[model samples]
Target: MKQVLSGAITMLAGHPVAPSTVYRLLAKAGWRKIVPRPSHPKRSGWSRRLKSSPRR
Candidate 1:
């Protein structure tokens, strides 16, 4: 954030904007936090289990 501000200041020599202002701008621009999903425990062997299980 500060790096962007410093670069902008060097280019524009404009007034200093606060970090909160930059965060607000990013939110307004639709930036979002992405998170990873948890891995499934039985991910590898579904077909093997189905074939090996006894019939109902």
Candidate 2:
């Protein structure tokens, strides 16, 4: 959240918009906060985690 806010501030530095205003604009544009969770009903996290493990 902080990284996104910081980038917005840098991009709109010359403007008089506040961080809150930038968030509002983003929301208006259909941006949403995504909560991490299984994208499918049958997707198990343990198998995915094991597959992502570093090979030794």
If scored against the real structure, what TM-score would every candidate get? 0.44, 0.39
Q: lDDT of candidate 1?
A: 0.69
lDDT per model, in order?
A: 0.69, 0.74
Clashing pairs in 1: none
What residue pairs clash in candidate 2, if any at all? none
Q: Report residue 16 deviation for candidate 2 (angstroms).
A: 4.1
lDDT of 2 by residue, 25-54 (tens): 778879898887746668798977888899
Model 1 stretches with alpha carbons more than 4 Å out? 9-13, 38-56
- Compared with the true structure, model 2 gives a TM-score of 0.39
Instruction: Name the candidate that leads on lDDT.
Output: 2
